[model samples]
Target chain A: MSVSVQREDFDVGLEYARFVAGRTDVGGVALFVGQVRAESGQVAAMTLEHYPGMTERQIDAIAAEARARWALDACRVIHRYGRLVPGDRIVLVMTAASHRQAALESCHFLIDWLKTKAPFWKYEESETGARWVEAKETDDQAAQRWRR
Target chain B: MKILYFAWLKTKTGLGEEDVPQLPAGVTNVGQLIDWLAGRGGGFAEAFANRGLVRAAVNQDYAQPDTPIRAGDEIAFFPPVTGGVG
Candidate 1:
């Protein structure tokens, strides 16, 4: 279990390798990488902000819940903080399990929960002015599917 | 009390972070904190003018406006999140 909230970039391949290292029981692994995108029809860079202590706790809880929901071998969640520009990698989530279904489902569950539940905020610096991005309703609805 | 700012809220607040005096006895939660900050004039007032649009976290966890707070706790003020980029 690795959960880090940092500004440093991470290599998904290396992290995945480390996660599976010495884990003979693990039969499957899934990964998701989120990146800052240039806003559509806007000329602004992206910035991310998060609440320090609570962010770690909330994410850890999410991971723990996923572990309880599935039989997992290992899991890792890395999320970046501070100022970030377009194309920067912002978060990475990887999970491993004895079966493909568990690995895949857990991965989905992790990202879905993170999107709506994590306490991170985003701001886009645009030509008109800086805009704070709202948490998407679509993300909330997607997360709801997992609870059902 | 320490208050941290993030994203656009940081921009609007001018100061990214500040250490403020504890609110009076009855001002025990985020909503009261916002009302107090919004009364502080200029940028503080403008930043928190629209209380409904603001988001807050107490001691680093996402919290509602009515979340109770204690002294020495770190309260963060910002807008709703878009998400983390990988």
Candidate 2:
């Protein structure tokens, strides 16, 4: 399990290469990258904020749960903080397992849980002015299905 | 205890954090603490006026209204998370 909450952006190619290097036991890999939405030019930029210590711990716990539920060879979560413009990468969830089922399901599970459970918040600087993005009910429903 | 605010809560309260003095009697949980803070009026009242919109964390862990709060604890108040992928 690996989790990182940082201000710097990550390269998807490098992350995928790192995931596959010297992993003879891994037969399947799943990777998901989340980018900031452009919102039809209404949103100019977004400032992502999170509890410094708690955000990392929470994402780690989510990754740990994915490992517990699936037969995963590896799992990694990378979420960003600070100001970012539209189309910037915001998060990455990667998982590899001996089977495709574990790889896909665990990857989905980590992202779903992170959507609602993580401590990070987004404040948008838009044409209308600045406001915090409200949590969506759809996101909650997405996470609800994964609950034990 | 150190009380912290984030996102809109920081903007609403106009403060990032504040060191709170020891609590008086009968205030043991987060709900009561919020009530006390709201009673201070002005921005505190406005920030916590709607209980449904606000969420709290005790010692960096997601907490409920009944969650216990003690001295030296680090409490934070903020809205629900909106930090995942699109």
Candidate 3:
């Protein structure tokens, strides 16, 4: 399990290579990358804020939970904080397993859980003004599906 | 106790963090602490007016309204998380 919260961007290919390096047991790898989007084409930039210690710890816990639920050989979560524009990478989730189902399911679980459970916030700058992004009810519902 | 605010709450409260040597006797739990903070009036009141919007963490961990708190604890208040996709 690996989890990182940084202000700097990451290279997805490099990260994936490092995750799978010399891991012969892993047969399947599932990866997801989240990027900043101009939902209405009005967003100029976005500022991501997070609680320092809490952000990393929460993500680690989420990754651990995903591991517990699936037969994952390895899991990686990298989330970026600070200012970013549309198309900038914001987060990444990668999971490796002996089978595709485990890898894919774990990757999905990590992303869904991180959306609602992590301690990060976003502020968007647009034409009208800057405003804090509100938590979407759809995200809550997305996370709720994982609860057993 | 150290009280911290983040995101919009920090903007609304006009403060990022504060050191409170001690918490009042009634501020035993997260909920009571929020009530006391709201009583402070001014920006605090406005930031805490809507309980539905506020989220709390005790010592960097997500906390519920009834979570126990103490003088040495580090408490944080902020809006719900809006993290990016996977």
Give per-residue CA lDDT, model 3, range B8-69, as digits (tens).
89998999999999988788999999999999999999999999999999999989999999
Is 1 or 2 the stronger prediction by DockQ? 2
How much lDDT does candidate 3 score? 0.93
Worst 10 residues of 3 chain A by lDDT: A60-69
Query: What DockQ does predicted model 2 obtain?
Result: 0.83
Q: Mind giving the per-residue lDDT tens digits that candidate 2 earns over B10-84?
A: 888889999987975688999998999888888989999999999999988899999999988999999988965
Q: Can you rank all candidates by DockQ, best first?
A: 2, 3, 1
Strongest candidate by TM-score: 3
Per-prediction TM-score, chain B alone: 0.87, 0.94, 0.95
Which parts of model 2 have CA positions greater than 4 angstroms off?
A: none
Residue-level error in angstroms, candidate 1, position A134: 2.7
Query: Please, what are the lDDT tens digits per residue for candidate 1 over residues A1-148?
Result: 7799998989978987788888899899998898877767583576677777778898999999999999999999999987777777889999999899999999999998998878888767888998677777788788899895
The DockQ-derived docking category for candidate 3 is: high
- Index of the highest-lDDT prediction: 3
How well does each candidate superpose onto the true structure, as a TM-score?
0.87, 0.97, 0.98
Q: Which stretches of model 3 miss by more than 4 angstroms?
A: none
Tens-digit lDDT string for candidate 1 (B6-66): 7767877898888877665678999988888887788889889877778888887778878
